[model samples]
Target: MNPKKLKVLSLVLASLLFISCDKPEKPAEKKIELPKPASMLTLVPDDTIFFAGGLEPVPLKEWTQWSITHFNLSKEMFNPQEIQKLREEAKTDGQRLALQIWEDYLATLLALDTQFASWGFAEKPQLASYAIGLAPVLLRINLQDVQRFNTKIAELEEKAKVKAKVETLGTATFRRYALNEQEPLAHLIIGVDGNDAVFMIDVGIESQQTLALALGQSKPEKSLAQGNRLKSLQENYKLLASSLVYLDHQQILTGLTTKDGNRMAKMVQQLASKLKEENKGWLNELHSEGCRKDLQTMGANWPQTVFGYTAFDVKAKPSKVDALMVVESKDKPLLEGLKSLRGFVPYYSKEAVFAPAVFSFGLGLSVENVGPFLMKQWTEITQKQYSCSFLKEMQTDLQAKNPAAVGFATSMASGVRGLSLSLLSLSLEKKEGMATPMPKELEAVVSLSAKDPAALVQTVAAMVPQLATLQIPADGTPVQLPLPMPLPFTPMAAINGSHLTVYAGAKAEQLAKEMGKMSLESSQGFLASSLDYGKYYGLIGDVVASVDKKEGQQQATPQMLSMFEAMKQAKVRVQTKLDFTERGLEMTMDMTSPE
Candidate 1:
């Protein structure tokens, strides 16, 4: 109640108010800057292909976590801790010092980009993607420690391996290495400060003038970083991915028809000839003007950029793969048919469900229709029989099997809306290495959309005899009575509703199981994807695994053989899918680990 005490209390309250009004001192905010992919564009010229992409950066800790799970990459080959221990021990030792430096440097590598650039190709090259002649391929790697990286480079010559020598290009210095002695393959330019390095293939560097320009010493008036085409393309694909790939359709097509055009023509001719021989006159007169025009029209009418992005959601329970891709459309003649063509999407068979699932694919009515339509168009243009022999056989066989239905439909294709075919290789269970290449044995299965169950059985009974393979062996063997089609699907076919199915192959047992055990209505993994791109170039449309054991032992085609070898030898299993839509053709492919 005293005046002095009241004044003191008021002063204390005022002091408390002043303290509360002053905001609590906040911790300094850390600013994080993500690397701009646009900066990579600055490294290339305006004449650069629109197809360019790179890895999106993450915080260092997140990157370490992702690499451990995604790649299982560690500092050591067998054990990360052991590798680090050895590396640390080797650092001071004379004999292991070089090895230690290598280990240290390699562990510090953060990211790298491999870019395909056509700087020296013909100005109006017809086909660019097909430009295999020569192009500058840039390999850029971001590193953490510069000194160790430099040491790693210098110690390379000590391994008694291919010698690496230093060469100067304008203001830039390159450590050159040639797998081929006559011509060095790689001319690597390092950053002056050492956290980065650029590897340019020595193939396209004719003069020092362009090399200087590319090195950012005599900087281009306009940088690729300033370019809008690639920047927009990344945005269009929503390029927030760990990695991505893009194709320059404009440059590729131009290269194919331009300076490298002849090579392209020869390749097509060779393929056509081979296909005709194998399929029995299916691709007759392939290199003719009409055929060339057809091919040209399909390729020419698409967007310049076709891109694909891949990311992993490892946090998910099953760890799903989140792969997405986009292909821009064009106004082409076949575009209408691609969009309108409809039927079944690709199916993951019952065989796929239990059979180690090698590869399975289903194509719709639109794609099957292309053969007949092309046959008609090609026949009219070339004035020759351009029909598909397989389709022809299928038509005849279907007619013989189901007279009334075949008569109504007329063509096997007309009666058929789509074809579902898959190859499953069960190498996963087999421990023994294949002595020879696995054969792509076709399990001939006939699927018809007939409503009557009895009619479908009678249809199978008739087809069993005709579809059997009659072989006059090279060794003069007796001409045995024609063997009935080798299958459990003999005598009668199973009918579930309107769908009738039959199978023929050395390993046709799976088909028999599939017919009765797996219902036709249950088609999982059936991709009803749109066919937008005119044609896919990379790894799309090649998800086939050997289905039969007998087929696995047979000789394979060179391409099939190479792929099978990779499947057997390497842990890499590449998957590719090609789809059609009214908008454009779509192509997607990525490497996956064998399950």
Candidate 2:
């Protein structure tokens, strides 16, 4: 590997290990009131294009230890013995340097004296200037004891056979590492200011200004803390957020489009012109007045999107994490329009979601009034006669598809409220000794909800003319569907006033019948899913066995076999739920792995 690539890899590995893992909190050697993680937002420039905030403060020493332990626990998957042997056989300076860099940096990070670390990023931009533009980007890591941190950096520099050049900007002093001595297109800038370890790539001449903004020597006219946009989101989600991300689409688009003589903008304009000359005029629509207005309207309608973790519990009996993302829009008409599209899928209560299955998924799709909604949107756009060529083309395409939407609305969409699919059971038959086991059973169900059972049956009948001959009951009763071809298992379908279900395999019909009484409570979201990992592991093993039995197929490797053995002894289950509120949509997932 190139030394530069090794250097980048070392930094990335150290960062990932340092920030993502955790262990039990230890008592601080000396009591101190660490600032709230959100306080880091005060340093961010208000015009930031994108920002990701790590609001949880983690004890660096404990975190590094935990990460190492977790990696060790999963080392079999990587076959560590092989990796170590390969390291021992390394001959080149770069290869030896790579292994040394990993060890030296890992040790340095693990021994850090810092009690807790919090990080933040502002103004998302290219980290290196392999591009034509420069945008303000800043990365800050909250630190204590700058001397200890610098000492660690010194050790890394020595091991990597690279040198750091100490330099200053305004009142801030930083260490700069050139990408290469001959052609230093980008420089990695690392510095300490007050409590932050500021990092940014010096991509251009304006980098000093960017670094100054990061170091607080130069301040934004209005900092993100002053904006208080996250406050409402925090309150709305009721999360003591471990992390939050904010993207101002409007600000980002305006910056990209409105800037005069912007290199990127000019390049795009050139491309559009070339395309227009070839009679592909849609690209030109981007620079059109109508498109600009439409974009502005779009940005205004949904000015920003935010994401935050509502609940996070990694130290529990079974670690769990829950996060929420919201697309904020205050436009009454837009919000009302989305509300009308909310499907009738019911809430997936614990009891309602659980079934005899390895994996199950259910989705709520809007069925009612879709035709009229599409027609209304079409009318508005057509009546306005959008001048943008792209919009005109899209309108033409939608007009062609409008009849299909109308057909869907009148037949199936107007009647069905929700859909559910479940993998009921899967297993391998017992085999003695070395003989490969055969598939014993597999079953699944597909179901939908509706107010009128007969309507659902009629809809299916219209699609499959053969179904019209069966004397299907409106009451919940299973009816076998005739297959045009031979199959190993029987397939049956049933319809009730509330649900229509199709079952594959013999026992699946019972599950279909039960669907008649199953609650159709609103899930309050578009989709939800659950997985039983213990069962999933068994399924995977059976699949691997079957594949291995195939002629000319290679048997499972020892490492892969060992991994499956480990998985068999572990119990894990995951459930996810999503919901849309007046503000935006929020999805949460919970994973349980009890000892």
Candidate 3:
């Protein structure tokens, strides 16, 4: 009675089974584990005000290759023919030995292909009360091969005939090179612990506790690596950085001003007292309690700064870098004031940045409010009536000059919002054997933007009466400016609804016209710059040639010539920008070279 029904149900179940088999189980997501700061950071004391560490390992060859290229030390320099020529040309034994050592070092770099391990610097406590002296420093870097490094060092020492004195502190032994015979604290000390090399500068045996602390025999009560600050930084910048830098601005200011619980502060007080005894009234102003409080107030604006690389692509056709720097601040008014400084950047500004040029820079500023902002700051300083003697004087002067400052800030010229400076083109004359090669072709432009272009031109014209007579148009039209003195290139000016541009060179009028038509608004940022190294070096070479000729020389020195040759091979380009974001003021730089 149900045969048909049973067959239909079986067919439906078969189809469901086939669908389930085709659909695979959802794969589990994999979490990425981020790298941490250098292990040696754990030994750094909590009192350390500044620290910088690398999270990713960098090959030693990277540094060597850069040095080789920058110094024009090519493979040919190490070849047998060049080596013989260099030796024969050496004027002294010192020169010959130095050349040989550099060649040996380069050869060694080829054989040793090891990479650098984690490294960091931790500021050490100073033991003196002098107003000026080298600050104590401690740095630790791990060696990939201690034996090979030590062997190379030994060879260098033997060749130079200058030996470092061996000294011991507890169980740790170090090689010390005295930088100054009269100063006990001025020495470069290097100690090896396993694969880690501990370096100390301006530290003496008198600082036994410091020596022990640096050697890691005595553990600090609190360490940077074990702290939540570094942990938080690592977590926030996870996978985005190969290195990180931390600065404690508040701690530094406090340590300098506080009289209690800080040896450096105490030393500062003692120095201040000695200066007072010598009748140094100017230096004594800083030692007063009023100055300390003023300094503390200023320091509260920015307590700390953190920096790291967001992108580092060295393997690209041209290497690129993007970094982020954060100033940890909670003062809302101060932040708002700083943020207000950024103005409307037009799209043409970016065109100017990327356009082929020796050098170019663009800066954006909120022109409308800058005058009021500056006036407000000056008023605050004067109204505060600071008790510090030096500050009191400043306050008095500002109170007297505030009226004039207000007038200047509120002037029509202050309405300008953006500025761009560029050296568009440059070339030397082609005349053979000329003593001074005059610029045959040169172009430069300075473009300005304003809230009221007509008002700005009127204000400028009032100052330069000659400009008033021309009656410059407001329809983005270019007008040649009359000058009392002759110029190498024609001076041109143009004004649109928002932009006022000035130009000099053969193409000044054309560039001004193009600038007038620029209508696209630029992306938000305060500053941007671009440079072409190949063009820059070419200009520099011409200058050097001119200078040599003026000094009665026919050609530039060999070193200068070699540098020009190397620069031609690299053909590097660089661009940079500065902007404000939720993360804080961010600056990015990109550097690339041709393959």
| Top-scoring candidate (TM-score) | 3
Error of 1 at 406 (Å): 16
How high is the CA lDDT of each candidate model?
Answer: 0.38, 0.56, 0.56
Candidate 1 accuracy as lDDT: 0.38
The reply for model 3, stretches above 4 Å from the true place, is 1-38, 63-138, 159-161, 181-184, 234-240, 259-291, 326-329, 344-354, 385-403, 430-435, 465-473, 477-493, 503-521, 551-556, 579-586
Model 1 RMSD in Å is: 21.3
Q: What's the alpha carbon RMSD for model 3? A: 17.8
**How well is each residue in 303-352 modelled by candidate 2, as lDDT tens digits?**
88776556555466655545566777767664566566555453332223
TM-score of predicted structure 1: 0.51
Q: Write the per-residue lDDT of candidate 3 for residues 1-595, one digit (tens) a residue.
A: 1343223223322322221111111111223221233455556666566655543433323433443443334443344555555545544323333444445545543343331111111111001101111223344544545665566545655764556666676666666554333323344455665455565543343355555666656666666656666557757864242355667776677666666424345444544554436675554566578887887777787677876555555456645545567777766665677677786554433433334567777888866666676777777778885767777887888777765555465565566677877777877764577666676666877777776777877887789877778666788767887889864667787785577877777564465566565542544458887777767776777677565354576677666666665554545566677776555666766555554
Summarize candidate 1's per-residue lDDT along 1-595 as a digit string, tens digits.
Answer: 2343233223323322221111111111234322243454455544344423343432323323333344433332233454445434332122132333233334433221110011111111111011112334243333344455555556544542334455566555655432122221223232221233443433323325445544435644555456565446556665433243455555444433333353233333433444435573424433344444544554566645445344443344433333456566676555655554544433442222333334445554533354555544444344433243433454455444433332334343343344554443222221247533232343434444322434434444467766344332222222323343442223223343334444444343345344344333343222432211101211122323322346456433445534333323323233555566554666554434332
RMSD of each: 21.3, 7.4, 17.8
Query: Worst lDDT window (10 residues) for model 3?
Result: 122-131
Question: Which predicted model would earn the best lDDT?
Answer: 2
